[model samples]
Target: MSNGWNHTAKIESLSFECGFCNNKVASDIGFFNNNNIDGLRARIRICPHCSKPTFFLGSKKLPDISPGNDVKSVPEEVHALYQEARNCISISAYTASVLISRKLLMNIAVSQGAKENLRFIEYVDFLAENGFVPPNGRGWVDHIRKKGNEATHEISLMDRDDATELVTFSEMLLKFIFEFPASVPALPSA
Candidate 1:
């Protein structure tokens, strides 16, 4: 009944198609749990048509939920970068998102003691080398980074196309970080 994630569900107000029955059914049963280390887990019965089972687990945490494992599972710097990248995209600030993505990539590189030089192409290359991004994504990263540079320097205006691209890149970066946090090495001393 409890998996450790906070959730609120009203059984009477819930209705969904049953996956198993392939028919509409009222959601009469609700289960909610708040997972402290991760996020929320909820299970609800929608219809007899689909009266199977539903599970939802929010957030990813270290295996076993141990404090030390959790700490070692995801670096704070990487999480911060993810948050900033998400914020920039949510606000439709594509240029800002691109810049922040660059910073995140750079931070990962520096943490691994890799090259610290700041260049669009180099940034993509570093991301690829560190396995934080797909090898073919280099071109896309370079494109966004260049676009961000022009906008930041006032050489070009932030356009919808650029903004959309930046958002996509941010999303991809966030997914990568979530899947492979260890790939982002620790940052070097400033």
Candidate 2:
């Protein structure tokens, strides 16, 4: 079949988790090329669910579309918000990702016993003052608040870098507050 690359090769099909639609799909080969001498291969597959294309060099997908690593031992509600923020980045929804990252901080604070209904900045302060925000991480955590405010109050769009930073900081914060604490063995009974 003819493609934009003007290459002729047998069409192939493969099953993968579609990054665009987040579905397991059997996709048709949209394009393919191989260099036998060096064993390099490039391919594009059309996701049946989203009708979008995923590019692969050899077996690795380009622009990795997976969300950030899951934080162990997070509260169920907090984990959901974290996943939402991470998923937004996977789909290039940077603004939504940043917004969700902001919310995730509040959720984390509340789950860790901070009172709800306080001002947004208060939630950040709660995290910082209570030792949830890592040492030297105040700057990074504050960046999320500032970026989130800009995305919320101003006429501007959050970009991929902004979203990635916010989400990554959130991941580290979650690990510090929930996962690491959960891993510590309990002291022997007094």
Candidate 3:
């Protein structure tokens, strides 16, 4: 899961469906040192998560985000961006999906009365601090933060699975922030 020495990539982990085997798994990446070139452009080596000898660039995007099912009953502004994110995921545009999901989270924060003019990372913290998202949810939301950063700032592509995870997390977050609360009634005074 790393480019060889003289390469600048740390890689770490990449989750995707193998184009060859059509199985979803986190594929480990490593540089293929042919001609001893140290650049990543020529070093895109794919590892089969399965023991089978198959090379895959990546698999088609799964329909992970659904506007009709996933975003139904969600608030309007948030739902619009969330649907966009989901649409991106369906088309294998993980980068765009992530960016839209990030925006969705921001919209959720604002809808829930979080202060305006804060950065995206701050919104995550605000959600946790304000009890909009429980403490345990912070870690996964932070994962979205990382993915959002990569999607916005890096040239390297992200996997559909990664964006899917972010969308799923966003769906949960939206439910916690909006749908669940709306369905629940306020308690009467004793």
Candidate 4:
């Protein structure tokens, strides 16, 4: 008998990408929680590569990290780095995300005509001094710089809130510098 739903009577092995290891493989289902009234099934699947458990609520993964905001008309290289930072958050790599957010500041500055090989702080300053950083955005840009420096120099790990804030700020900065400017139609040369 075939039911309209995609649920199977019994699931032995499931194929999924391990969030921790980012590997696609089939692994044995460790256990399942079934709710008869709601027909909801929660499964814990073990990742063979990382030996970690991923929680799935009826095939929907838990801890579904937000993918961050999307800005159009971004340069290809900058877009790639921005996506990398965003993807790091999805894998719970908060520290990596924070670091990438910091690097993005440098990239943005250079893309906006700032000189290369400048000190990290200089990049932040260039953005602010040249009117690249949005008004009232210098604070959060500094936050990204400080947190990123701590992640690099100290023995501390970045939390979700820190990563989210930096990534969000980076998105806004990119929009301000790239997307928003590209959005306007260029005036015809006289």
**Cα RMSD, each candidate:** 13.9, 7.5, 11.9, 9.3
**Tens digit of lDDT per residue, candidate 2, span 52-169?**
8787767766434656687899999999999889888776688999999999989998998999899999998998999888789989878989999999999999988999888888
Q: After superposition, which runs of candidate 1 have C-alpha atoms over 4 Å from their true positions?
A: 1-74, 117-121, 177-190
Quick one: best lDDT, which candidate? 2
lDDT of 1 by residue, 18-56 (tens): 434445556656555543333453444434454464442
Off by over 4 Å in 2: 1-64
State the TM-score for model 4: 0.70
- Candidate 4 lDDT score at position 148: 93
The deviation in Å at residue 132 for candidate 2 is 1.0
Number of the top-ranking candidate, with TM-score as the measure: 2
Clash tally, candidates in order:
12, 0, 0, 0
Q: Worst 10-residue stretch by lDDT in candidate 3? A: 53-62
Task: List the global CA lDDT of all models.
Answer: 0.54, 0.82, 0.68, 0.81
Per-residue lDDT of model 3, residues 48-164, tens digit only: 554432222233233322432364467788888887887786557878888887777788888878888998888888888889886589888788888888888988788878888
Higher-lDDT candidate among 3 and 4? 4
